[model samples]
Target: MLISKTVKINQTDNRVESVSCGECKGNKNHKILVSAEMAQDEDSCFDYQVIQCLGCNRISFRHALYEYTQYQATSEKIYPDPKQRLPIEGINLLKPYIQSIYKETLKTINNNQVILFGTGIRTILEAITQEQKTPGIDLNEKINNLVKQGLVTQKDVGALHDLRRIGNEATHSITPSSPKEIKVAMDVIEHLLQRIYILPHNVKENLSSPLKNKPNTK
Candidate 1:
């Protein structure tokens, strides 16, 4: 049996905590709006709080567990997780499906979905190859095709292969990538997307007109 009590905190309560806000995309001060406690037994209890970010006014739920028998330590988790990486600049320039996959891949890593993270990374790479119409039967050959098409150089193929290996390990052997490894992989992907999609779009939008008007000397 569990006993619980809900408390409605007033605006004047002034209880604030530093937490990551999805809208703000970083840690900010959040004021507690409502709080509740449930006691599973004499030795353990759970705390739930509704918090609103002071900066962005974004709301989030925080849950914590306390055990008196375990030296009064507390374990806390935030609902909906927190944003880990912001969308890459000019992400809208990519194909719609690729943009969606890229955003979801970021979320997967942010939520600590290790297996999904690897798979997502792989999916992003494959989507790029498909969008570019690289001719290959499999991902390995497709990645190499990217080089022949002048999409990526020999140096970049090595990094793409590393990402492919990580994905394979996760999908086939159930291996989990570390956070640092995930971060590097994401960086590489972002760079590739920027070079192939965003940068070209930017150049065309910003530089094409200027170059067109330059007086030709030859």
Candidate 2:
């Protein structure tokens, strides 16, 4: 039921709310630095505010929507959608282009760009295969070659194929992957990256000396 209500802009209302902080990469308490309200019509209004994160002192814009209906709850949105993911440890160990694509893919998922997310996931797989010099004419063959080359296991091949299919659907048919599918694909990709690049590098750097130490021979 739509009801008419007067919207009031309260500049002095000091309210704190939990909001996601891009800089902190998590939810934090934010204080309203400034606020204004605009009535779209008699039944709805928007609250615009400049909010500062209490933890990091980072500032961002927020838009909240309110409707005069019994069933509707307040809707709040943050500008530049709070970045919730951090770069994987040892991301720099990846090829520069792969690193760039990985970071952008994270942002794409966070922005809810479902089509781009699928494409990005597939692109990352392609770039990895290329960088590893996995020889194949197509993505399927390339993924299979990864197992033959010992870069990924046969079990991983199935997951990579899933990613390939998601990317194919998004690219050729413009089909958006569901959130659950995206999440699982992302987990698979990240694990693949760590297994292929990050973990090996870390082991070599941190454990090699101990493992390679040999008794002195005169």
Cα lDDT, all candidates: 0.84, 0.86
The whole-model C-alpha lDDT of candidate 2 against the native structure comes to 0.86
Q: Pick the lDDT winner.
A: 2
Model 2 per-residue lDDT tens digits across residues 1-218: 45445546664277888888988888898888888777777776777888899999988899987685732227888876685555678899999999999999998877889999999999999999999999999999999999899998888899999999999999999999998998899999999999999999998887777634855665
- The regions of model 1 sitting more than 4 angstroms off are 1-83, 210-218
Go through the candidates in order and give the C-alpha RMSD of each one to the true structure: 7.1, 8.4
Return the lDDT, model 1, position 144. 96
Worst 10 contiguous positions by lDDT, candidate 1: 3-12
Using alpha carbons, what is the TM-score of model 1?
0.63
